[model samples]
Target: MSRPILFFVIFITLLSCDKKENSVTDVQVLFEKVDSIQINYLGSPTVHDLDPLSQRVVFMEHSLSDSGHEIFIADFDGNILSSFIKDGDTRDTYGHIMAPLAIDGENSFMAYSFNGFIHYDFDGNLISRVKIVDFFNPGGRILGMGYGMEKWEGKYFYVNRGSKNADYGDKDFFDEYHTMYLLDPSTGIRESIIPFPENSLFMKGNFFFSRAWEPVFHISESKLYIVFGLEPVIYIYENQAPFNLISSIPIELPDYHYFKGSEKYNNEDVRFFGHRVTSGKISNIKYVDNYFVLSYFPGFDAADTEMSISTNTGPDFWNAMRKKYTTRIAILDSQGKVLNDFVPEGLSETSMKVKNGELWMMGKPNGEVELDYFQLFKVGLTTKGP
Candidate 1:
């Protein structure tokens, strides 16, 4: 084949998986529940960050205070080491929204917020805080919820919201919106690199629905992996400067179903609620070891009472709707082939992380369990003949 033709063939393979056969026969995934750690805490807590070197995990609980958050540090044994509510000076308290925590290094972690990075030790002591604007100005539009950020190859990488004047009606809007950026705090230089994929479903037609989801992504070694909530595609990019797209992996999840929203209703309109609630979304993504770990909510399909939008609009509407969908975890290889996909009992969709080369997930609370206690476990993957 000519060089141009070979390049075109490879590009086509990256774009879609319709021509490929099922890869499950070649790879089998077996998960072994290693051990469970029961943590004792007051309110409901979600895993914010895990530090294997320090043997500590950070949990965030909703606070009634003006700052709206509290932090707890617990060891691998589930013993609460320290807990604190934001207080003292402006440097100590974060913004109203709770920023996701990233493990900085040994015995310390950092929170990336709209203002900048706040450093804290595992003992609940504040180290220092740096505002990005003071060092690197990200135009006038950097004050938004950052999805996730990490220091890779001496550069800070994070995803920020796109333009405020985004024209949703335009078919090309999603492709042009830059959502990822690289910042060198030391050099005071920043560059917006990745945008939504040009071949994304949102870029396909008049799909004007913007779920306002913060894209979940991770940088592992020399590669970057990103997966949007509204789509099932995992995009791979080079982890260096310019960050060009390497390939696109479209996943065909089992039992996944969705309903595309109508363009007439804006993102916030009530009329779009049915489509938004019924749609299947990629809830979480993480790259661990050589595999990609993903948790997703397979869209609910059931009786009228379960799916009805009108009857479900009570105070507990959101909670009730959540019970209808089952959350499943899938282990995918570096090539985006599903090795194993199954729903594990007693695991929360929001609290899974890679710890010491294994997947650790926080336990989902059953109504019978005491609210103060949290469960943690290590998932071991074994390969067998399909």
Candidate 2:
């Protein structure tokens, strides 16, 4: 074949290959329920999530106070490899570790605070800071909730909301929905917005929707999945500028459609209730090759309090609430079809992560205290014969 014709043929073939859909992946997935394997580490604030590297795993370690936080890098044997962001006071290099964004475990990682974000390597070496005060929002536009962002393929996707106490131009002080933007990593400018369905707001209130609601984003390959920490919905999109919402999955959480007003709480300042109707929501999600593994809590019924001596959910509220409810998990295929559903006892999705072909999470044997152990669940996939 001539050079021009050969190149043409190769181009055509590549285009067709890109058209191949995931439905053709004959890979069948199964949860083996292999007895839980516990990491040698234990205690309150145990390893929350696992970021599996070829040689180690990295998790964000937070102390009782902000100053002692560090990016804890450890081995499966529970030996510390290296810890990053040694001192939170190093404001020039590292900011307060408000929320752990993610770490590639090799080149770069991100940590978030109320101010903005700081980037570092696995060794805690500073790469740069994405400071909003002097860098991005130099205008000091109102102080809204800062962003939680992730860097994928050299681009950044910032997720957060506007302020609830201060307004900036068109944005309301009590905005109900979370806002996402495709940000320029070099300039820290919002290039474009990623729109969510207006109906997806858990509620239209102020702090209830803004403060209590947590959202998580998982990126696998070239796809991004948006999961509400307090709702059983998954929004999937192509991971790119102006992320195209390709599909959505509703996992049917308890009272997901139920809503109420805050007047019942005797707080007129609070807005209406939607997510408050249900005490639980989807806690975490992991996107494996051809499967979507997610975990959720069914929530505790207040009526259970009437059945027990628990007159008040005081200092032991978390323990009592955990004992009061159960955790559920679901497995879905690339087609958004349910493959299998199971609720494992003592499984928490609060910091669940899919790593090295396993579902990793924080769990307790029989917790009277706080989450005390990190465990792994085996996820099995078998390719059927054609």
Candidate 3:
């Protein structure tokens, strides 16, 4: 064959091979069974916070039968450690706890928009209360909700505050914004590490935002990683403008309809669905070694009375209408190159944590949501050889 024809044939062969590799659809669960536990609260557990250092988990319990909210603590194995009510019996009316119980070993911190921030010791003793001011100016335009707490070096602790304009829907209201702050755990003094910007479009929505909601952290002692949507951007300084763009990874999905089956109405006769597609609403992102994992939940449409009602329609109709998409975990390199893709079975509430030489995740088994239980699994990654 001529040189030009030989080159063309080789190019076609390589393209064919790439298509074949991408078309394969064998999904496998990577995590091995370690242990499982069930969390029981006095009422419905709305939000939970985990302290891996102390192996402690704290959650908020609100009684649907009554109008009260209580904070409870437990070990990782679900053993009840402590429980207390912050607001006596005044009824939190908010219906749910907005913040997680921030725990640092024996010390715990809880923040409520209406009640401000409260601190507690490991034994669930009230230590101090800091009334967060300055942000929420006159007319209460700023609402500071505690998102995540991290212990930096020495007594300098960091509390991430997400702010939203109080009057969100009105024409006179401005768009919501988010900012992070560094605080002295002992003196209760906080300095604005990152100031709140007006009309910041990082991440703002009812379901999820690419830049906002996701936790930004210092991946190493020096390097910080901030995940904005599918892209993970890094910054050298804690308070640096024009963040150095690190890497952007593209999230690959099988089909658009994979997330459309979960549409339904809730008990309140309110249609709860995503106006946009689920693939667009990226839920969680975590950094593991050199790779990053992104997880998303399908969006639902408006809810009607018959949203949860099931019919005896054949298995095919049920399968077509009630189908659920497998949670996708895309492994990417530091330069944002997709390394591999895998789908784990029985994965619910999928969140990532790094420990030892493996990637740890907490999720429930398939079809176990009806039972109100969840499980944790560990997956060993083979980085040396393919």
Candidate 4:
């Protein structure tokens, strides 16, 4: 395994289960900015997860001169408690830290890179490492690369897009392309579960859409919550061996538009299609406590995207889109019913995590402010009485 491959797989996955609330309560959701924290780092880091044990933020700062990737643990008051860099050339650094996993137990959290899973303490010391190949049966070969490793309720689940049963251009390609597996690290036993919904847009040979968008999912409370990009629907599943579908909730999004892929596009055309495309799509699906937070682009005009590319102003187009389109978040109850959906003010759509039962979001960047510190703010969600 290499760094980019692991990163892409991790990206695809960073890209949920909790309890039973069968009834949808009729209430309005409101977001209020509460407290804020700042970290004096300027590498455009991404917040991976909040460590429950230490209550510190686990984030990554990349492009650090020559160190490859660095993970940092910091307090809410902008204090960097500890940080470590994992270089592929280093002997025991797990061949470069690819992605950080949820905090494990009280002493440490887990991360995966090109080598395998690496355990590190709060002080950024390597506790142990397990190779990726060890997760399979001895002498048993896997046809495709195993990527997107997520830990849920003591077991590890990985998504493998390769299959011996189908090829890329086959009619059943998409079905085989999205196979997820459940693995027990203790026994090295793996079970295949969860495939792309048969009725998904990509299953009908819409490869362009798949190329342009990646699926976002979360497993919570022994259940799987996923929103395929370009599809404004949440698919809930029982996160067991068979991964049975529980419910499919269609989200009512305002100002949402999507591009339908044309079969005539080739590989090069797909790249161009993604660049000139303007569509409203779900960017992330996160499960927080009892509710789910969904981030989405509220649609952009194709003419505007085309003008930016044609006028040599492409560099400014993306930031303009972020300011104009503005990411909208939808709050759904445990049962996948929409409680409320609105654009949160002064919050960036980068990463949102729940801390102490409140949602924390990255502060949206204003052009006027120098990018010297990373700021996070707590957004309190309240329900209005029916």
Best of the candidates, lDDT:
1
After superposing candidate 4, which stretches have Cα over 4 Å from the reference? Answer: 1-27, 134-150, 157-170, 179-192, 209-213, 270-272, 275-277, 287-291, 301-323, 333-339, 355-358
Sort all candidates by TM-score, best to worst: 1, 4, 2, 3
Per-residue lDDT tens digits of candidate 2, residues 32-77?
Answer: 3333445444533444334445445555544475457555665555
Better of 2 and 3 by lDDT: 2
- Looking at model 3, report the run of 10 residues with the lowest lDDT sum: 6-15
Candidates in order, TM-scores: namely 0.77, 0.63, 0.59, 0.75
lDDT tens readout by residue for model 4, 249-344: 777655566665555445455334654356677877777757777888766666764564464656577777666766667777766666766666
Off by over 4 Å in 3: 1-29, 32-47, 63-67, 89-97, 107-113, 135-147, 154-219, 229-279, 297-327, 353-360, 365-385
Residue 243 in candidate 1 has what lDDT? 83
Q: For model 2, what is the alpha-carbon lDDT of residue 281?
A: 60
lDDT of 1 by residue, 49-80 (tens): 67667777777775465655677888877778
Candidate 2 TM-score, true structure as reference: 0.63
Model 4 misses residue 97 by how many Å? 3.6
Candidate closer to the true structure by lDDT (higher is better), 1 or 2: 1
- TM-score: which is higher, 2 or 4? 4
lDDT of 3 at 120: 69
lDDT of 2 at 241: 55
Q: What is the lDDT of every predicted structure here?
A: 0.63, 0.49, 0.41, 0.61
Q: Which residue pairs in model 2 clash with each other?
A: 144-163
